[model samples]
Structure formats: structure tokens, C-alpha cells
Target: MPQLNCIAPKPEHGSTSDPVEGGLSLTKMSSESQNKAVLAFPVQPKPLQLPLYPITLKFEEVVYKVKSEQEGFCCGGTWGTKEKTILNGITGVVCPGELLAMLGPSGSGKTTLLCALGGRLSGKLSGKITYNGQPFSGSVKRRTGFVAQDDILYPHLTVTEALFFTALLRLPNSLSRNEKLQHVEQVITELGLTRCRNSMIGGPLVRGISGGEKKRVSIAQEMLINPCLLLLDEPTSGLDSTTAQRILTTIKRLASGGRTIITTIHQPSSRLYHMFDKVVLLSEGSPIYNGPASTALDYFSSIGFSTSMIVNPADHLLDLANGISPDFKHPTEQSENMELEQKSLRENLKSSYEKNISARLKAELYNSEINNYSHTKDASIRSNRKAEQWCTSWWHQFRVLLQRGLRERRYEAFNKLRIFQVISVAVLGGLLWWHTPTSHIEDRIALLFFFSVFWGFYPLYNAVFTFPQERTMLIKERTSGMYRLSSYFLARTFGDLPLELALPTAFVFIIYWMGGLKADPVTFILSLLIVLYTVLVAQSLGLAIGAILMDIKQATTLASVTTLVFLIAGGYYVQQIPPFIVWLKYLSYSYYCYKLLLGVQYSEDDYYECSKGVLCRVADFPAVKSMGLNHLWIDVCIMALMLVGYRLVAYMALHRVQLR
Candidate 1:
């Protein structure tokens, strides 16, 4: 006897002791005397994982009356609606990590069974999927990984980047960057996606990787934390025989490594069929047999499904489950109306057909089991890894998310966009502000006010457009656990700061230069900050709108309306703006930006060549002595409030994934 210790096994030579399971392994530590299990393990965390709500599944006396015509829309005036019945009283058990494969034809209830397993069953399902001897409550989604038929991936992100991003969000802080990357790389290698490791998942226009690779990537993301149960919706669909075999091989490997894998496969190859540990044969929504794949023929034979000797055994097995296709021929003398009525009746009375078929199926199963004394295996559940909470702390999540947001800004070309915007604005600003030899009061006054009020316009448009693109990427990452929405909002605000500064700086310097509105450099810089600050607030508003709306179309429409209203209401009319709506002049982001723009419009804080108030009225147009209450500092304060308010609204809306 020897003592078993959970220790990180030593690697031979240059090989790393990195465990494939992402947890500790309990191995025998050989000594002189007795064998016992040690409490301590040589690992970062125990590689063992268990379901959050460990439950034993049982399907007893289940009679699911199946329906026909899964989809239909009610007509304006119709006697009744069309219908279809795919399954009747079908039932089966699916324990944790249990690989339960359902085999049937295209219209059979295999897909329905898969959906029911995931609690996605729609259209009249009357069976109870009990967990731990009780009806399932479906609070175990966090512990499950469902790989659907189509791989859900962001086309823009590469496999490694996507995996790393998922890990950074999903894995705990204890897992180092190298460890996470190692785990991700290990999955890629295992799934044979190493070649396309850096390739995009591809899309309608952008081609990057193969279907199987995409599927494997989906598995990789789901498996990042090693889920308790894996429910795959045709994990091997849309692949060639070899590719299907490889995919199934990976699935089996996962199952062999103590992961439960359940999938619905249609007409698997003979070799592929043999690889399955167990198969559930369903015909007309009723399970004929659900047990080991090895005794598939015997189970069929017991239920009077003797395979034709001439047919291939695999085809013979499938025919029992898929049903024999027989041509129907009616005599010319037969009543057409009666036949039509029969057809109509079949369509309308799908549930009756399902129940009848289901009853017959149960009878056949009971008889077969009785004659062949079938044995049920014990539901032996094991645990190695602990379940990690899906919801994370706001701050920790924020920091990680913010880092990602800032880093990913490179992808959006935000920094480049900002720099170019600022430099361009600066050049334009310099020309606008170029020395103006103005002696007359009226001309200088008009020139200064015009440059100041209009300076904030381009910043508004720039912020509005960029928000949409950034929002899209943010959504994909958020779903994949890249980070939280609040962190992104804050980072985005900060990230664009340097650029915001540059845009206003360029625009201010250029406009002042061109117009000869120079007064003081320091006052000019302060005004530039105000104008840029306005853009920041507006962009934040855009982010809020983007988050609030499910898609860009609505957001775009709303933004257009908003921009138009602000442009009109922000004291642009200066004189004719109505009294009651004067608040709009104050509330308008443009108003604040304009006010601040005017605050240092000329260039100096020196005495006015003109009287200044809200109007900055002066007999001399050029040299206005007064700095107007333009209320820019309030605008600054309000802009800050608006940024936080909009950002908060966007974050909450996005965090919930609120669809329009």
C-alpha cells in the first residue's frame, strides 16, 4: 500500500509540468508501507471540477405528446392553423458528463430532445426532466457549456485573442497570464485548431477558418473554465467523414477526461457510431432503446426490428430509427375528398398520432427489457474542480475590462483617429485664429463670436460616428466575458482624452490664426479644453444611446434627431431663440461647448474693446473688453455630470444586454 498525493507531476527534461486538466491530480506517492489518500495536492488548484447543482436525472412515466409543423403564423381569417407532430411521450435520463447521443431522421424528435435537455424546448413539451429526484429548475446554466450548430464567434477577433480574452474574464486572478494562455493553447492543440490559432473566425465577407476550426474555437471558449456538463447541438454537423470523426474523437477525449458530453448526431458513419459509448434510438418522438451502442442490433431485434441481411448493418440499424420510406399510391377510382380529409386530419390531429406512437414505443421497450433483463449503471459522480461564480465583483471586473477596453482601442484605430483629428483641428484652428488686423469694433466682434460658437461642431459629429463601431465590438467581447460595460465606458472616456485635447487644440489654434482672433494663449488653451470636453460628453451620450438600443439603426436615428435639435437650440439663433425654450440653449451640449469656445474666442483675457455680458455687447466690434458669463465652467460641470450620467445609463443597459 502507498499514499496518494495530489501533486504536480515532474516533467521529464525540458517538458513543463503543465497539467491538461487545469487542476491538481491525485497520484500515488510510493513509500514503504500503507496506501491512503492525502488531503494536500501539488497544484495551483485541484484540477477536479464538479457541477454547482449536482443532480441525478430520471425520466419516469413521461408522455410527451409531440407536435407537427413546429412553426406557423396565424392568418387574418382562417378556420384553423397548420400543425405537425415530431414526438410523443418521449423520455430519457442524462446524468452529468454523460454522453447521450440521440439517433433519428431529419423530422424525428432528436433536435427536440436536445433543446429540452437545455431547457429550450418550445411548442408543447409535457415531460418533466427531474434533477436529483426533483423537477429541474434550470439554474445550472453557468455550470454548463452548450455548443450550438453554428459557432458563435466575433469575426474580427483571432482565435488566440478570443480565447485569451475569455480566459482573462472567466478565470480567477490566481490563474496567471501564462497559465491561461497555456490552457488556451492546450485546447487549440488538442482540438487541432493550432494552425488557425491566429486566424479570424471569418464571416459573410471575411474568410478566415474552416467550419470545424470554428466549432473547435467555440468549444475552446466554453471549455476555458472546464464546465460540468457540455450540451452540443450537432457538434459534428456540416463536416466531412474524417472531420466528423476528428470532432467526435475530441468530444470522446473530453468525456474520457471526465467531462460529460451529450450531442445529437444524425446518421453517423459506421466507425463513428461504434465510437459512441451509448445511443438513444428515437422513432417518431418515442425512444425505442437507450443504452450501450454495442448491443444496438439486439435492442432493435428484441423490438421486432430485424435488419435485412442484404442491407449494410449500419444502414440496417439506422433504418430502424429513421423509418422505412415507402411510396403511397392511390387508385384513380378512390375518393379524392376522403383522401384529402385524411391528410387534413393527420395534419390537425398530430398530438393523437404522437401519443399512439409513444404508447407503442413504451410497450416495445418494456417487453424488450423484460425478455433481455437489462441492467442500469450506478450514477457515479466525481468532482475535481469547484464551480466558479458567473457574476464577478464590479471593481476587479472593471479593472480587467478597462484594460481590455484601452488595449482594444488600438483595433478601432481610436488613438490614430484622435491624433489625426486633433492635428487637423489644430491646423484649421491656427488658420482661424491667425492675426486679424481689425480696427473696427463690429467686424472683430463678429469674427470672434463666429469662430468660438462654431468650433464645437466637428467634435460633435466625430464622437457620434465612432461610438457605433466601438459599441459593436464591445458587445461581442462583453458576451464572451471580456469585461464589464461600466469599465469600458470609463476607459473609453479616458482613452479618447489625449485625442480630444488634440482636436480642439488644432481647431482652436487654426481658426484663431486664420481669423486673427488672438488675445491670450493661456485663455485659448482653456477654451480648447471646453470645446473638447463637449465632444467627450457627446460621445459618452452616444455610448449611452448605443447601449440603450439593441442595434445601430435605432441609435443612429436617435443621434441624428439629437444632433439636429442641439444644433438648432444651442443659442445659434442668438437673438430669436424663444424665452420658454431658452433652457434648451443652456441644456444643449453645443451651448456649453459654444460658450466655452467663446470664453477664449479672441485669444486674451484683456479688457474689452467692446462691452461683454451674455451678448458681449460693445459699440466697437473688434475689441470686446468683457468675458461673457457664457456659463462655460457650468457647462464643464454639466458636461462632467452628463458624461457620468450617460455612461452609467449605457453601462446598466449594456450589462443587462437589453435588446430593443
Candidate 2:
């Protein structure tokens, strides 16, 4: 095995400097010494420690493993499980004011290492990841900003609205509402998103901002907090060359502000490659090269791996990281042993990294551990730390979320299609049972039962998509310690209440007088209340199902079956269910609400003409008899309990959701 003695040395006064085009700072590296030129870091200034949190991020011997199940028979075994390592003995250090880029092919654990550095990984992780030589804690989370590869903004909100709401929810209570808005404006201006501040963040179906703008908005969202350590996972993954350059330029500016930034990039151009201060090349969960970005080519050249053709440095490095030498040989030479050759090359690279770079990284980690006490004792740093568990009060979170939710969900809840659906149903029901006389006993009873079945599953389907659609966004916000889970759950549930009830209220008023079921205002009011109550209970069930399953297709299917079962045993279709399974009606909220609605419309002494002059009491009707209103209050109590109980289940389900 060959040895690599590449370590970045301090820069001298007069050295060959490579300046990034388009106004980025110049990078100085020594050209006089062969050893110094092979591994040289740009001379970055000492970070200002006045107002910002100047901290270092370091990881040591980080290892992560997961259990993978084998399905087919292996060595006479029917089924087997094995522990697969995702990241193996990874080690690196990133000081404040430096931008480190992780370059690797797909499935090489670039994102996994990024997530581990951000304190987002959950299980089977063994490592020493520290910030400013301290363990990851709540304060460390507050100081860290993570921008995921996928943009998680609400599609309905404008750019300004999105950032403003985030500021409200995540910023400390010490800042007033006006100050938060001011900060949002500053961030928008800094990210160059002012021209499209009022534009909607559209999705795959809807057209809104461009790809570059959306990516910038994602970065601006994290920048609002002025985090000391920013970790972005492929911010420029989907953009073109020009746009990608702009995104990296913006990231470079952020790093210039004394914030430590790390990102994962795949196949970057030459211009984009040199913008990073350091680069870590990974292959199959192991880092093949970790050194200054500008000197990576020179470092590889000394080890019998140099590219003669003019190509992008990053492209050449990626080829080598993939176990392919950049220097091409004749096609006929060594064609039969290509596989064996690449395997040996990969092993050589890995072994060389372990011997050369791993020792120096461990020494740096040791020195950082010794200086951890000085960082903790800094009085100025301690003053800026937040001691409270949450940034805002519970009521403040609810208020902000309520306002935001109402704005976000208003169009979906009150769209013309939904309005048309409710109106069409109301009018059709009114015409079918128009102004029936007191003699028709069963017709009015049937109308009330249909009301129970329609509202039963309508709101259910609407609320079933609440959590699944926002699962990614919820995890992002909660992991940053934005607000309490209770605040978000209550705000979301409460904000939808009025919107959920509006259409049903209009429907009830439309059909109540048109069908002439009850002429008095008191009966109409009570019927409307019961209808709204049933809508809430149904919506709560939908929320619970959505939270528990967290998949739209599966949750919708289960909701369909659950609502159908409730309708079948609701005392209307089947008058006398089998005694063995009769208790399902007790479980069905529809049963209780239906019985209560019937109780309000008819009395025990009310009589109606059943046949040609023969009369019968309303209570004697089979539907009413099977579901007698003797304990109407019990039904209301049960429905009330269901309303509260279902929401609790949903809350607990949301609380159990692991944030990563």
C-alpha cells in the first residue's frame, strides 16, 4: 500500500492565488513547495465573535448500521436478517467561516452523513458529533439550520407570507411581530427574492415561482434565524448551470458572514467546484479523499492518478472516486481483468485515506476536546443562548398558526367546486322531499337519516389528507424546536372548525324550511347544531386515521370502510342487527347523532296519517322505534365524548411521530 502525506499547510505571503470568478474572494495556495501545493486551504479570516455564534462542527469515527432482512433462502436458512452499515468510520472537521462540500455518487451516504452532522439521525448511530466542542443539545438545535433537498413550503402561500409565518413561529418572543416581519423582509432582499415575494409557491400541478427561486426561498427560510451552522443537502440539485452557480454564490456569501456551511453536491462544474473551501469525496460509505477543494487534483496526481485531458476537476475526481482511473488505456489492454482492477483501485484509495488523513483528523478532534471548556466559559456566548424550552408562548403559537392556517386552507375549504357540491346536494334534497304534510311519517324520517349519512363521510374525506400531506413540513418545523406539538394540533383543529361548519350550516338552513320538517326556529337551531357536531366528530376521526397511517391512499381507504360500517349499523338500514355484533352501533358516532337529530324534529304524541285516513304515532315508526329517543341526552353526551376522544387520539398519534 502507498502512503499519502497530504496535509493543508499555512499559507505564505506570496503564493499563486486562484480567485473565483464573479466577485468571490481569492484563494491563496503555496506554489513554491511541492508538498504544500498538494494540500492547501484558502487563508480564511478569523470569524468575528461579537454578535454571531462562531462555532466549529466536528465528527469522529461516526458509524451507522441498520438491519436488512433477507427474503430468499440463504445457506439452508429460510429467512435471515443482517446488520448493514450505512456509514463506516467517517471523520471530518469544519471550522466556522468554511464551506465544506460532500461529493459522492448516489447511495454513497452523502445525505446520511449530512443528516448525522445536523443531529437528525435517530437509531443505531455511534459517533462523536459536537458543536463548539459541546454535545448536541436544544441550544445547538436552535443555532443550527438545515435545508433539505426537497422544498417544503406550503404551495398555497406567497414567498413573503411563507417566511413571515416561519419567523413568527420560530423566532424568539423577544422580537415583536413588526420586528419579525422586518427580519423577513431583510432575508428576502438578501436572497434576491424581492421581485417574486408575492408569488405563490406552486407544486407539480400548479405554476408559481421558478426552480431557482424556489430553491432560494428554501435557503432564505433557514436564513431568517441567522443560524451559526447551516447544513443544506443539495440546494442546487435540480437547477441548470447558471442557476446552480447563483445558488452556490449565495451560499458563498453566507459563509463569508462567518457561518459554517456544508452541502452535498453531485457532478458540479469547474466553476461550481472551486467555490467550496473543502471537499469530502465518498465512495461506498467510506471517504476516499478529504482535503482542500482547490488542491484535490494535485493530491490525486501525486498518487499515480492524473488526468491528461482537459476536464472539470470535479468530474475527474468523481471518476476516481468511482474506482475509474482518469488516464485512459487502450481498449484491448487488460480488458478481461477490468472488474478486478477497479476493485483493487478502490481498496487502495480507501487504505491510503485511512493511513494518511485519518490520523491528522483524530489529532484535531483531540485538540478540540481540550478547548471545549473555554468555549463554555465565554460569558458573551452564554448571554446569547436561549434558556427557555420554546421561543414563544403556547397562546402565541396558536394565534400565529390559526391565522396562517386560515389563510392557507381558505381556498381549499371554500372553493367553487366544494360550494357547488354542497349547494347541489341541498337543492336536490329540498326538491325530493318538498313541503311534505304531517300525514307522511316515513318520508320526513328518511330525510333526517340521509342528512346523517351525507355529512358523515364528507368532512371525513376532506380531513383525512391533513397530516399526510404536511408530514414533511411538520417534521422540518418541529425538529427545529419551533412550537409545542399541542399548540400546532389545537390550532390546526380549531382553525378548521368554522370553515368545516359553514357549508353544513348553509345546507341545513336551505333544506330545513324548504322541506318543512320543523317549522319552529328552536328545532331548526338544534338540528343545525347536531349536524355541525357530527361533522366535527367525523373530521376528528379522519385526522386520527391520517395521523396514525401517514399515507394518503391507505388512510382514505380505511376511512371509507370505517364510515361505511358506521352507516350500515346506524339504525336506519338494519333495524335489528344480530345481537352478537350489535355493539358496533354504539361505536358508530353516526348512530348517536342520527338519534339526536330525530329526537329534535318529532315528539312522542305527534301523530301522522299512515294510510288513507288511518293514523299512527311518530314514535311507533319502525326507524324511530328501533332508535328510540328515550335517552337523547346520552346520545349527545356520547357524541361529545367522541369529538373530544378522537382528537386526543389524533394528537397522541402526531406526538409519537419521530422528527428527523
Backbone collision count in every prediction? Answer: 72, 0
Give the C-alpha lDDT of model 1: 0.57
- Looking at model 1, residue 365 earns an lDDT score of 41
Candidate 1 lands at a TM-score of 0.66
For residues 546-612, could you state the per-residue lDDT of candidate 1 as single tens digits?
7666566777788778777776765544535667776666667776665565565543433443333
Worst 10 residues of 1 by lDDT: 1-10
lDDT of 2 by residue, 456-510 (tens): 8899999999999888988999888888889889889889887799999999989
lDDT, candidate 2, residue 409?
Answer: 82
Worst 10 residues of 2 by lDDT: 18-27
Tell me how far the alpha carbon of residue 160 in candidate 1 is from the true structure, in angstroms, after superposition: 2.8
